[model samples]
Target: MYLVLIAWIYVAFMMAIAEATSPVGSLLGAAFTFLLYGLLPMSVVGYIMGTPARRRAIKAKEAAEREQALAANGIQNAGGDDASVAPNAHGEASGHTIAPERKQP
Candidate 1:
């Protein structure tokens, strides 16, 4: 896919170079060749080729959001703020807990 795009760019670059070198063709003609043959088609093709990847990313993001929604629903249905909390070093319940300190014998 990318190889084709690269080839197109190379062709355009060469076309522009050719136009610039030719006695009959001006810098404007070179610019026209580069734009018409290279940038325009390549831009369109790149966007078209990129559609599938864009779609896949969107779908994956939706799936993630759906999973999050389901998980949130489950947590709400379960009805426990306590469940979100972890037991502390002293066995106290908190949002986050510290590791217990080990006493040396």
Candidate 2:
């Protein structure tokens, strides 16, 4: 029980740090870390699992942003409508629907 409590506290701290460093919804890494650590009794296993999980979460977030950008730029389909695509305050595509330019302007 004590170990579990300690693990929970550790997870909370890690998650708080993650949340503070990244943008919105970036604390998923900490949540995943906490979950995995809480589920497993071995600290070694928790560390191994948590590391990759955090990395995967970050990669997934980046990929999502990239996709949104592509959609916004019109390089990719925005699910068939402008409304479906995320738009900026000015109603321009949020760049998720459009592809990024490879060349410098």
Candidate 3:
């Protein structure tokens, strides 16, 4: 991806040089050509292509933070199989449930 961007920038720089050296082209035109065609489009493309890597980095950071919090709480192997996880220590239903009512005879 970066290789393609570098090649495009090189091509644009050459085009800008030609435009600036042309008798009918102004330096302002060359500058605008470089900015609009070369830098602007490539920068946008780079940002778009980098989105997946950014997301992966964010996920890794969050996982590391979670592991650190678990370690601080003296928990280990939190990601292991279900048997490693303990059941609710309180040994009670967590919320109230309504008992079924009997129909009137």
Task: Report the lDDT of model 2 for residue 76.
Answer: 67
Residues 1-105, model 2: lDDT tens digits: 346557776776776577657776456665665556554445565576578779999998987887788767676654754353433547676548867889978
Off by over 4 Å in 2: 1-49, 77-105
What value of lDDT does candidate 2 attain over all alpha carbons?
0.65
For residues 10-65, write the lDDT of model 3, one tens digit per residue: 99999999999999999999999999989999999999999999999999898788
Tens digits of per-residue lDDT, candidate 1, 1-105, equal 899999999999999999999999899999999999999999999999999999999998986775587577553324433244322435666665878899999
All candidates: TM-score: 0.68, 0.30, 0.78
Q: Who wins the lDDT comparison?
A: 3
Task: Return the top candidate by TM-score.
Answer: 3
Error of 1 at 93 (Å): 38
**Order of quality (lDDT):** 3, 1, 2
lDDT score, candidate 3: 0.85
Q: What overall lDDT, based on C-alpha atoms, would model 1 receive against the true structure?
A: 0.82
Candidates' C-alpha lDDT? 0.82, 0.65, 0.85
Tell me the spans in candidate 1 whose CA falls farther than 4 Å from its real position: 75-105
